[model samples]
Target: MPHDHEHPHSLLPPEPALRVKALETILTQKRLVDPAALDEIIDIYETKIGPRNGAHVVAKAWMDPDFKAALLADATAVVSELGYYGRQGEHMVAVENTDDVHNMVVCTLCSCYPWPLLGIPPTWYKSDAYRARSVREPRKVLADFGVELPVDTAVRVWDSTAEVRYLVIPQRPAGTDGMDEAALMALITRDSMIGTGLAIAP
Candidate 1:
């Protein structure tokens, strides 16, 4: 007979996260780990770092044509000038989305993402479904992500590898011309940089 009951572990967090939580709990009980410190670290990554760095780059590009040109020409050098370079981000390529072209990025192999600029890869980005579907049916994937590109817009999927990581610079929304870089940064989402979504409108 086939098993009818769900496995107990199925209800727990995914394997890696479950293991980390278990370890944290054990260390906390032993008074070896400071939960407060861990929380602060998590908060920093979740809010203050990663995607914010990419947003800053996007905002600057939106404001400065020279920087935008330089970013597209040599993403690694230009981005590093802003102090956002590190492992998993050594080689960077910036692709711009325009009225005629839409760029989407995916790691067909393991998730070789730009960790410094984008923070940790989202769980969805690392999934086998996304890795395969994003390349095979980019329009459908984008639609599922709530991004409906125009029929005339050409969708281009870039495969990210350890040698090169691509960042999508979403087209600046209309009426955002008066906004400053700080305000502009708020419009840039991580998903936009990943080419799965557009910049938030002001």
Candidate 2:
């Protein structure tokens, strides 16, 4: 008998939020995880701790040129000055996006990320597809993520290793010179630090 019934499995999301839900479901079904605990961790990453810390870092860097210079020179120390360091983010690197260069990050081996700053890494980031293709076809992958760079803009992909992870300092959007730190923080997002999206405009 040709069975048309689809096997029961957690339906994953096409976007970030629901993807976490799906990952949790899969782990729970395997009896390898606790849903409540997972939910709590996810909440902390999404709201209280993760992305907010990265936003502060990016906002401060944008506002102060000297700090920006220091950040680029020694990312680990500069990020530490902001007090963002933890399990998956012990070593940090900041890559700036300018008119001539677009920076992206990926862990080819696994889902190594700077969670202390950016929060729970996105589902797409941890996926095998992204790990494999981000290095080989970065331009195509960036296009899929909706970031289209200019033809002459050089794309640099930073491979996240066990010793170090990267944070992409997305180019500050135009017309935001007058915005304060709080306002600038609001413009930054999880994906912007991950190099898959841009900061919001004022």
Candidate 3:
């Protein structure tokens, strides 16, 4: 899902899921691609890793001020300490959202993302409309994602690049002081880390 450029979306028809299956079938028939490898890759993202991984990182940051400081300073090293850094996540930056500021991330050129901490990119993250609209009209774009900020809160859009991917550390929600890190993680959504959604309330 990572690319580096304002490359136009593929003209492939709207039925990409089916089209991909057809292509995969053909590649298997010709023995050009390994189905086992494909399955493994899919399974890895679906089960082994996903937003929950990032949620854990976020929850820890919410609980530990020192850790949060380290994360904001250098997310790569802080996350790597938990063994979540590789591939498209080589360079990482954590953007914290405050009471008066809301942050949103978009890859203007590509779907550059931190796959280790956040897993593979979501389907919409790879859409051209999102890439084009996020920077231009972030508040409106966020509203479409069901995120409506207060009138006084300033919206900050972060454009992720191949060199450095940004992760939004959404503000910790209220009524969570009694909750443990693991419990708090369950309230964190992938979109929250992507700056497209907010953490769920208890």
Candidate 4:
């Protein structure tokens, strides 16, 4: 004879926020360091310390037609082509921005970013204000970022979920007729991919 038995599934309960708060309280009580310093350190690490690999990828795509085709077809390979492949960006897709269609990226569920190319996402990108406001008012958000699109331009927003990530390949600016690769790279800023700023003309 057999008897019905139940086992507790939640052997270890989930208390991520509570644990974090407890650790934070302990640190604060100990006067380990200023809380604001953590933010500054993080900012410095992401911007100054980390690799600016995304700019390199963007510049490469702009300069090499074959590389651009490879990048658009398979971003991971293209990124690896320049020896900058990694965890989040093991997969990538290069979306081209056209005259009539503009591209923007957002991660609604979490800040799943393409770290291999873009490096660490900007602070504003991971902010709750940006997450909530982006989907609600995309055009307005773009406007707030000083990106004025033509009235006829259709804004296409890509939500970066768990599996997929995207990067925008802005159209090369006019007057770069004879600019070389190094010169072209100077025009590729992170803001350009986000559609907040157009590439500077050479």
Candidate 5:
């Protein structure tokens, strides 16, 4: 039931649901929606349309001590320095993930994501299923996403409200002591900022 896309609580209207269901049924019958299309869409959106601003911020923070300090102190000003400021990001905080704790974000009500950096919210992220389940069973929800935290690690759930949005600055992975900015950006996934995945080791 958790995976069901239809429920009275869904924000989608009945007409849209019917059309989507019909399309899904047709797609299943014809096998028309290519599996690779999903990845292709993601690639286009992330690389072409989605702002690389967040990755830029992360790289600068890693390389410049003063900028990093300013970012930790006030993310908005630091972001504006790169001409990446936006309505949602006007007041942002870069929470650093550590060994003792992990962070995950949820809106609890609507899907309030860092669109200037991450682009459109993923379908799963906007679903009522995720919104309800995240608060009720955060660990389980995270585990379902393949993010397994240690038993002793505390999970901090930051509910994005109407006023503020949050982004996580995942700790730089090891074995990349001398990696440059471009290479480092390749390792920063949207999930890392959302706190659902750790940055991969370069």
Candidate 6:
């Protein structure tokens, strides 16, 4: 006779968030990590350093033609001068979205994201489903993200690697000519820099 019951662990959903929580618990129990310190760090990245940094870059590009040109030509060097160069962001390439084309970035092999600009990569970006589908059917992926481009607009996919990463510069929205850099930054979202969404219209 065999037992009909599944293992208790099997009852848990195969979600990465659950696994991360479990690991954190274990580390905390072992006194290897301080929850308070971890929370503070996460807060800093989420509120101060994450998407805001990328938005600053994007807004500067939108307001300064020379900066935009330099960013598109040599992203690593240009961003470095702005104090954005580090670790996973050691090398970057900025791809501008024009009327005829759009650009998106993904790391199929793993989540090789630009941490300095984007902070932590979103869970979906590291998922196997996104990693596979994004390359095979990018237009569909964009549509799923609620971004509908003109039929004539071309979608370009960039694969981030250990040595190089990409930042997508979404087109500047209309009615933004009078806005300053800080105001422009307010319109830029993390997904916009990832090319899954557009800048918010004023």
Best by lDDT: 1
lDDT of 1 by residue, 1-202 (tens): 4355967455446788887798788789999999999999789678865898999999999999999999999999999999988878889999999999999989998898888799989999999999989989999999889989888999999987557988899999999988999999999999999999999988
Q: Which residue pairs of candidate 5 clash? A: none
Q: In candidate 6, what are the lDDT values of residues 21-124, reduced to their tens digit?
A: 87788889999999999999889777766878899999999999999999999999988988888878988999999999999999999888888888898998
Supply the global lDDT for candidate 6.
0.89
Q: Which is superior by TM-score, 2 or 4?
A: 2
Work out the TM-score per prediction: 0.79, 0.77, 0.84, 0.74, 0.74, 0.80
Worst 10 residues of 5 by lDDT: 5-14
Model 3, backbone clash pairs (residues 3+ apart or across chains), number: 0
Candidate 2, superposed: residue stretches over 4 Å from native = 1-47
lDDT (10s digit) by residue, model 4, range 1-202: 3334533323223587766666666778899867788789678556653335677777777778898888888988777878767767777888988899988888988898777677777888899977887777888988787778889988888888766778888889888877877788788878777665677766
| lDDT for each residue of candidate 3 in 1-202, tens digit (9 for 90 to 100) | 6355634334333587976877788789999999999989989888987778889999999999999999999999998998888878889899999989988888889788888888888889989989999999998888898889999999888887657878899998989997998899999999999999999999
Point out the higher-scoring one by lDDT: 1 or 3: 1
Q: Which has the better TM-score: candidate 2, or candidate 3?
A: 3
* Top TM-score model: 3
* Deviation in Å, model 6, residue 156 alpha carbon: 0.7
TM-score, cand. 3 vs. native: 0.84
Q: Write the per-residue lDDT of candidate 5 for residues 26-76, one digit (tens) a residue.
A: 676798876578679778666754536677788777777798889889987
Candidate 2's clash total is 0
Model 2 Cα displacement at 6 (Å)?
27
Q: Is candidate 1 or candidate 3 better by TM-score?
A: 3
Clash counts for the predictions, in order: 0, 0, 0, 1, 0, 0
Q: List lDDT for all candidates, in order.
A: 0.91, 0.86, 0.88, 0.77, 0.78, 0.89
Angstrom error at residue 180, model 4: 1.6
